[model samples]
Target: MEAVFSKEIQSGLDQARVASMKKSSRLRVCADGKKQTVLRMWKTGFAMEADAPDMRGMVDLYDGSIHLFRCLVVTTAEESGERHYEFKRATAVRGTPALDFETPEHAPAGLIEDAR
Candidate 1:
């Protein structure tokens, strides 16, 4: 998985969801700022066409609503030269921020843990 700060999605999200475009985007890092990379963030919400229903004569017409978020982080040693870019999808629940990005699938456990 790569953490890509998708510029296209970010711009589109900023216009559609005005409140979520925060100014700061820094990676979680060690005390010396030498171990991690954090990139910009873009959050948006959209819907996709749903697949057909199961047997029994019911068909789902919509894929339900989904939230999309992208982030750009530098590649870790584990990832080799590839940059870290991410895209997350989550369901929209009541009272939840509609455009918040989901957690990274492979974030480092911690400084000491990652060092191992």
Candidate 2:
């Protein structure tokens, strides 16, 4: 997919400066088509969320490099007061440095422990 950082995303990153100052990693934003997605990543784990006209409540989580373990959740509105939820799991190549997946001792908190 094609993605690019946009002005609105830059503004959000600017606002996240406070968090970065507090020792939290700065968040990154990229636009895929008309949708904007935010990604907050640290050494241990990362979280991504997206909301747009065609998509809403999209989330993805990963531990470490994000190529080994992943959990995705997509929520779509069906009708009045109704919503559809879809969940997916995948193991894909990210072309990043390989990580030792045998140990979870340093795994980030709030990650889906059983995502595999």
| Candidate 2: stretches off by over 4 Å | 1-35, 39-51, 54-73, 76-86, 96-116
Worst 10 residues of 1 by lDDT: 46-55
Write down the TM-score of every candidate.
Answer: 0.16, 0.21
Cα error of candidate 2 at position 100, Å: 22
Model 2, 8-116: lDDT tens digits are 8865775465335324433322224231222343333333333223333333332332423333445443331123334443334366768776757877767566776
- lDDT on C-alpha atoms for all candidate structures: 0.29, 0.40
The local distance difference test score of model 2 is 0.40
Model 1 stretches astray by more than 4 angstroms:
1-25, 29-35, 44-84, 90-116
Instruction: Residues 1-116, candidate 1: write the lDDT tens digits.
Output: 97666888765654444223112323222212222223232343211111111112111111122212222222222122123222333233344656567778998877764565
Candidate whose lDDT is highest: 2
lDDT of 1 at 7: 80
C-alpha lDDT (0 to 100) for residue 12 of candidate 1: 62
